[model samples]
Target: MGRGGGRGGGGGRLAFVVAMVVMTEMTWGLGDVHTSVATVAQLVEAEHAVIFALKDYVRKEESRLETIKRYIWGWQDGRADYVHNPINSYHFLRRLTHDFDSVRRALHHEDLTQALRANITSLRGGVEAAAEADVNGAAYSLVRLQDTYNLTVDELVEGDIRGTKAVQELSADDCFRLGQQSFNNLEFDLSDKWYQKGLELMEAKQPITHEEQLRIKRIKQQQEHRILMRQLVTNMAKQSDGQMLDRFSGLGIPISFQRQIYAQHKDVAQVEQLDDYYRRLCRGEQLQPPEAFVGLKCSYVFGKGGYRWLMPLKVELRWDDPLILVYHDVLSEAETELVKRISTPRLATTMVHSFTTHQARRSLARVGKTAWVRRGDDRTTDRILQRVEDMTGLATDTSEDFHVLNYGIGGHYDAHVDFFDLDEKSLDKSPHQGDRLATVLFYLNDVEAGGSTVFPMLGVEVPARRGSALFWFNMKRSGKGDYRTLHAACPVLLGEKWIANLWIHEWGQELRWPCTRDPED
Candidate 1:
């Protein structure tokens, strides 16, 4: 009901419920949808992107239909007046010359529906691929966004979040389905809230019953009788028009108004839970930086290589405990755009390593799509890897492929450590490729709103800025995994988020960053 009403009004009780449940289901998955604001500038270069293709088709088709409809309707309504206009006359000739052939071919088809079917068939493969499991996924995402942002059901139904507007308002039926989803997930409190809002909407929109209509008629007659008696008692002047007298009569009928509710904005200090830090940081609230980073200053890094000596990287020392730094202007705009183009075609659902089994599998904790691009995939990719080596002074030979990720609305990754915790017998372990020693994450684009790389334990939040890369050591100098380096990607509230990750391994960095005898080093 977010976009459509009941499928068939007369379909009995069971059918009505089914329609309610299915109507609000989103047509496409959020991860598959691209934001125009984020990608419109790259339209000429990314012509191969499916979103661009579809958008082009839609615009051309719509414009053609509008032109045809307007020209035909205007001619039919007033041919003389329409043709008298020089602009209209010119368009008439233009349409005959340009659009006539396409119109004739469509009409000549044995069945007019075939033209539509042919177009749909051409896009069916992509449509089916993008829509798989979309209903359940979309419902889950909406609920997650609701809980994370503390948004009220009324606010969401009205198509507003904090001050950002949704594309459209959700219908009463949409509310019912949302409540049903929450109930299925065993979120009773959230379910109750949605149900209450749905009921309120249904009651407000309910039409007057036959009995109520009859009661109103009776009341009107009694009031008329009373008016006549008063007229006789006072001997009032008789008005020729009784309709005018009816204007002064007051009939008490109740009208309903929708309830407005706003989400409570709590102070960052009041939020003490670990998960709360992620939400607060994403909301742009200031958090206390770690004490170790109090005296850290911005500086320049020439790495320990001849290549970087001429072009030192602008760096910001953000954290000191686990050694986190942000390298500014490390990537050019052209390079970032090329990475997005290469990764778009290969994007797939992101998978997480299971704690119990250590198997890579999909989970609700992370909602995004990712694709891996090795150094040889393209010259641009190779250049990016070389730049990573120069910036971090770490070898890229033992590192994994560049993992490019794109996050959609409400997309996020729960708190996680980057390094693998495998033993000798573990099947996931590679003999030569050591644990993930460090991570250099490049922000391909700037997020309009809430996408930030956050370290909840250290109360640190690094915002996504285009052309910037955040680097951090995942393991300690003593060759042990650092628990304090736990981090997560906060949910994207608005716009799009694109990132390329280069995970440097410990195998080739023995001398560059040597291990220490003291565990605390």
Candidate 2:
């Protein structure tokens, strides 16, 4: 997958892309999605969640250490490196990174509720534990959002994301922690910016240590070195190949430069540009439209199907090239609730198809849970399929089961197409359902903040509106993938996001959505 938030096509050659994508996923197992906050609602409850999560871990560790002390006394009768083992070292690092930092903030918080403050005593005995990976993932999520959306650290501290504000703003301590984590992650620019913000905020309230001051200075020095190296590389790139080698002969410049260029090449410099547009679209910025789609308008249209006369679909032309349309009130409140109720019990952590391994695996690129709600699962789903057929004038028989998804904290699906263009072998393994011809995504709930579905190529953002459905063609009339439809789900930054996707296949749509030699269609 591309770090810009999209599933990269399968092929072992895209391994470099995997490295950048996997960095956001998790170092260990699939991370705890609940621990990360993508929206303002999650941010308001963050401190409370962090407190309860860390309490039990601290209590248990204390007990375990007491037991170890007794054992050490009985065995060695002296102190040694009792906590030197891998497990102890691991937990110790977790203490510094997760537990201690969280607890410190909780202790110093001025806005903690009376009930939560009272529970602080019980935390002295026992509480809950959050995973280490979850902690790191949560910290990095803010950094990811900042980078993707081009949000300022000040905006983040104020909890003002694109004019959507949270009840609580991040504190100076929070800024410091973000900076510390960014430094650990080697994001020097972000680390320096966050550190500067923290220092500015902390100056009047608390004294920063001399060591901390020195650390910031060291970070500045590192930044200078990095910029210098980049300039040198750029200058070297302009030199003739033979001259470049001769100028820096014994310095191993050729080998090092080749490695650097190769790394940059495989990471998809163009994909990075695609991501820039993707982020801008998600931020609801307007991009220059293709000349053909200059003045598209919203209108009501009834298809040529038998059900067309019953009611006209409220269609908003999102993108003319790929024929993206948004249908209003396609689902009812009752049907939406019923679908969610059926899916709730069946929901499990969703997985992305690994391009290299050709298997589904958990990834932060997609953070949420999904349930396969088949057509016959209930009358509601069956009715939904009928409605889909009515709206698109396509056969329902070849469509896949409804994929009901509920996003958790920081939930999102990176940019990807619904069609499995790279999985041709597996496509044959199953009954010939054919490639995904079109998709109808039914929004089950209204999002308070983020969670807009964005198309990077076309600069389109369709916000989630309950009962509304967004429809788009994934394959052209020629049965080839239409890359213009490449889209992604922006991370939910506030209230819950619930959606159901119905992917209509090409097999039975041939008669309805007939093929054409004109690929552009």
Candidate 3:
């Protein structure tokens, strides 16, 4: 999830099944979570705006990340070490070790915010001076610093489309796309309406092409498939009286995602095997290690920098897109239990917002409850935040309250971006706390199956592990959202999944790491 500010803004389960049925019908990643649907769909259909606005925004942000990488590469002491390593790979992690002491020093003083600001100021001066002296070297050294500095801003843009009065909205193709998405989500009635509308638009313009005819035929077939799926789900829900989802754990297929995946990847047979294996794992059946985990020995544990923060000594699991780090046992068992106990009473099913009105509502896209673990004056609570501060090196005061999430069987979150989008500075709709810069997530408990944090874009799956933390950036330095960060929380197939989230914000980091306009190397 992206960061949220105090901009405190802020759903149910048969009602939930129905919603999941709708989500199941949409194209997997396009509509994504409900929050961005209206905004993104609007972008796609809003005429000429589609070509330059959405696509260019994405391209520029991606290019910016690449340029920063090159700049930092010049700063590196040894470029040879990274010859075979992609910027997003684990080998690039070597560059991050150098920043540990510098970032930690900011934490040494009592006023963390000021200390960090001072350190960043000093460091920026040094870098700029070096840039003047050696030009390329300033850009080449310590890439982790560049990456961390940029990603530190959380959800900078909310992509709020509210009150967009003068712009053209939802075009014909947009309706068709939404239709396809709804079809994937299993909202047949809604999907059909959208498709029919698109068909009408096409007929109005000219005669339908043979391919268009085929599209209509395929959609009808998909509608039939949805009918079958609805029957199965309704029957299962009836049989168990909605009390036992565990039984369906063995069904091992992307029931809601089938049509959507079929449309995009067009490989139903391959999906079946994948679905079966995933389900088997969810059902708690043991299997041989996959290629990714082969020869993996993540047994060794070590510490680094001043905090000597605990992290897995192995580099078995890593990814770049938005740079993810999965560190095991970062939190002790007692620490985990302590936070859980404090948060149990506060748990409530998670909710999404109406982008325009900012009203809280529930939907199937996210099927869990969340509560905050505030930075209280209590020693344990304060220490928990302190540990988080040490882990991330950002001032806690500038960040949002710690969020504790709980997931039971069937709980899941769909693909979504964590950053908010801001444009023209006229849209004052960003969250009060500021955009999320980076996300620090600690897995408080292990699941018997499922509950893996899956990054679809980066092809990374990190299963929940007790006391382990998964850290990643939500935004790039320019504060633009990183599309590559799109991720989902897979349905909890077995035991409960517990996690803690700390959203470090751009507002807080501004004082520490100021932004620069020229992102080019």
Candidate 4:
């Protein structure tokens, strides 16, 4: 009986061995088995321990790949850092580590078939998820997958997971190329866009770590510097034009008169000296004691005594040493008469009150005093206005309206635009049917210390002179508008300053009074 039992056991063993061999062969033929039969059989002897080990390895690898896929999807969707959590291998590694532990436990239990199945399913699911995520705008998962694959392949090729240094160098080179392209296009806006893209690519590189973050920061700094330089160039060009205008034609007036005007205003000279002193201070020069009352004084007057009205004013004395550009003031004799006529006390009161109450009949009234002196029409305003008109045969008609405003120190007019839309009833009672043409401001008195008409848009400052006026236009000949007419009167620093303003309206056949086109025959 014992002999029979032994032979039966041997037969059973042989049968089991044969069945295992056939299964292995079939699996190998189907390319499902990664290990040789000998190796499989070796593990199988201990209840399929070898197969379990093989399954464990595959499962861990699949989980790692899955983790990589997730990271790539995150990056591509521009959400890798959306929540302040960067998509990186470490993130994948955390998931991979957990999956690896599970595989290890299954392998230790000798569940070879189940472990292998889990690994394959996990890998397939990860790939599918990666594909879906990409379609939905997630790219970080794919990037993670590729990185992991490369690392695994490297391990397979060289028995190490870390990739070659060349991979890092290549990535850096690509980033450098992108940065260069942005810098060269002079498209600072676009360059910033590309530089950010390059930064992500550099950060995505695996195994090869460098000072990529620092390098990216440096690149951004360089881009900012380029933008600032471009702005500086533009500003310099504008300043150059202004300087040219200031020098040759005395900003439209003769150079001699400009010089004389500057000489007469001692306060202007002192303010200029102060500006120079400040500039020197910026350059670390020993500062000299500043004079008393160096800057402008601004104020506003709501009303006084029976005239309950609002009139804003500013006064500032412009220094003369580095004389800024002053544009031409042009006016016509007829226009001048119109200005003087309006300066009468009754007219001035009516016009000022009308403007304050928003009852001015004409847009021109909104701009000038009823009686403005036509300084620009006289020889004293600027020689260039006549020269330009004569050379271009522009058929110029210039004029000025003078108003004597007495405001004490610390008076200022808030910044405001001079152009009033003819269509806006709130601006003037009887709005001009045509566009505003030009403006001429005559400085009727040299302010004691401060009183300069400032055009912030043009960055031009006009100092007050006893008879000189500053001129500009609000409209172009083509009917286009200009933003240059926006101006402000800075604060009065020391004493009172009187000014004459002139606003020219578009020419039409309609005269203020009934007159024939050819005048009296």
| Backbone clash tally (model 2) | 7
Give the Cα lDDT of each candidate. Answer: 0.66, 0.67, 0.54, 0.40
Candidate 4 lDDT, tens digit per residue, 201-246?
6676665345766776787787678778756644553455434533
- lDDT per residue, candidate 1, 461-521, as tens digits? 8999999999999988777788889898987766668999988888878888898988777
Index of the highest-TM-score prediction = 1
Q: Which candidate do you rate higher for TM-score, 2 or 4?
A: 2
Candidate that beats the other on TM-score, 1 or 3, i.e. the better one? 1
Model 1, which residues run further than 4 Å from truth? 1-111, 123-125, 128-132, 208-272, 289-293, 305-307, 423-432
Between candidates 1 and 4, name the one with more favorable lDDT.
1
lDDT of 3 by residue, 347-457 (tens): 986886534444666755566789988877246778766666555566666667778899753466656666665543334333436677788888999876567887655
TM-score of each: 0.65, 0.62, 0.44, 0.27
When sorted by TM-score, best at the front, the candidate numbers are 1, 2, 3, 4
- Clash number for candidate 3: 45
Q: What is the lDDT of residue 439 in candidate 4?
A: 55
